[model samples]
Target: MRAIELKNVSKIYKNGVKALAGVSLTVKQGEFIAVMGQSGSGKSTLLQIAGLLDDCTSGQIIINGNGVSRLNKNVLADIRMKSLGFVFQSFHLDTHLKAYENIMVPMLINAEYKNKSAMKERAIQLAETVGLTNRIEHYPGELSGGEQQRVAIARALANNPDFILADEPTGNLDSKNEIIIFEELKRLSISGKGVLVVSHNDAVKDYADRVLTMKDGILEHTDEK
Candidate 1:
């Protein structure tokens, strides 16, 4: 099954910046795809489109078999909350919530599980998946950057979304932590979740099953490992 399909997608910002120009791509289920580009190369824009955080100026985005281009804002938000997982360069966990609570936020809002107990159990499972079982009670400020990102990753996975859209997820980490995070991402893909990440680090090329290089608002056909 295809996790995402973008056909001739284009995005032009209000300030008249053309971030993406007629880009087309397909991500199959369980594939690990990486988009490599410098700043302003449209990698982040592509991710936003795939995650339903932003709409394209033209063309279609089919995510998990649903056409997302024409969905109303409310429906789009629902799709975003339920169908996609996002990891960002900065750990966007709530400062006030403990790691477990942060991971549970999405589940609570989406009512992902039938009961409160089930939700809590799933949150704990995700925290353990991200290697944060012991740190689940720690607040974001109390955790290191890597730990915070792990919490964010667990939060993203709380919904068991079929697709993961990550934007420079390891950008804020040290080399050691970057490796750890990338390994977790790899595991996610290996476990049958499609993963698409926007990255500028050459190290990502080593981890990606396919690498797309973007330049001047267009994606270049690139080599893959």
Candidate 2:
């Protein structure tokens, strides 16, 4: 399935700074795509627009067949909750919540997981999948950076999203942990989920099925492993 399609997408700030300019990209199911660029290169902007966390200044965002560039905020929120998953450079976990509880957040908001007990069970399963089985009861601060990132990965998969959008997901990790995380994402893609990663980390190229380079707000074809 076509997970996401960005057609002539552009994003211009109010001050007239164009973060993205006529950028187009496509991500399909079971594909792992990596985007590389330096700071201020619009890599993050492209991710935000694609994930529906922000809107494009001009053009269309087709996510899983629905054009969402023009969708209302509520509709966009629904799509975000149901179809897309996100991981960030900073593991954005709630400080006080336990690892498994953090994973349950999305489930709580999702209509399908109305039963609290079932939601917790699913969260535990995700935690195990991310190698956090024993740490499921720990808080974010109690975990190491890698462990926290793993929890973040589990949380991202909580809603069983069609695509996972990761923005510099391994920016804070050590070399060893970076490999671990990248391998996990690669495995996720192999299992049929679309994974889009925007990172400057060289380690990512080894695991990506396709790598794209963004320069000065435009995406250019690039080499991959």
Candidate 3:
């Protein structure tokens, strides 16, 4: 089964703003897909809908062969915890928490890890994966922007979710850091994890297997490389 599938999805706000217009997509394992668009083009809305952070007005959303468009809050939370990971433009790390603690948040809440030491070990591995082994105990305030964003990415990987959704993940970084951030995302894709990234920078598309453009909440054009 595809990691995630959106079938004719549409989103209409309560104020009558149609953010998505019959958008459909299928993301398979190990595919690095980049979505590019200008501001107000519904890219974030699309990610919100795809990530189940917001509801869709109409359509089917299947993840791992199970439909989740209308699942209850508890069920949705369960699925989110088990099947999805997200990286946002603003690194959402808790300022008071250490990098290792931030990365351990997801696994701590996951029902699969009964032993706390295992969770901590996994968090350390994630920190190592993101090149933060030397700074695992640093707080977000002590870290650079790139380091903070790396922490967010590490937290996103804690669950080992089938897919990772990144919306403007490198928006705060310089050119060098932008490439660093995207290289980590590319590595995840190379390691058999499905990745969907929404970016405004053209350079980001270079790391993707497929590039798609969104306009007025609709996918207008696609290029596969």
- Among the numbered candidates, top TM-score falls to 2
TM-score of each: 0.96, 0.98, 0.97
Task: At residue 201, give the lDDT of candidate 2.
Answer: 97
RMSD after Cα superposition, model 2: 0.9
Clashes of 2: 0
TM-score between candidate 2 and the true structure: 0.98
Residues 51-166, candidate 2: write the lDDT tens digits.
99887899999988888866789989999998899999899999989999999999998887788999999999999998988999999999999999999989999999989999
Give one digit per residue, the lDDT tens place, for model 3 in 54-96: 9999988898898996689999988888778999989999999
Q: Stretches of candidate 2 above 4 Å error?
A: none
- Candidate 1: residue pairs that collide: none
State candidate 1's TM-score: 0.96
Deviation from native of the Cα of residue 162 in model 1, angstroms: 0.2
For candidate 3, give the lDDT of residue 58: 95
Worst-scoring 10-residue span by lDDT in model 2: 216-225
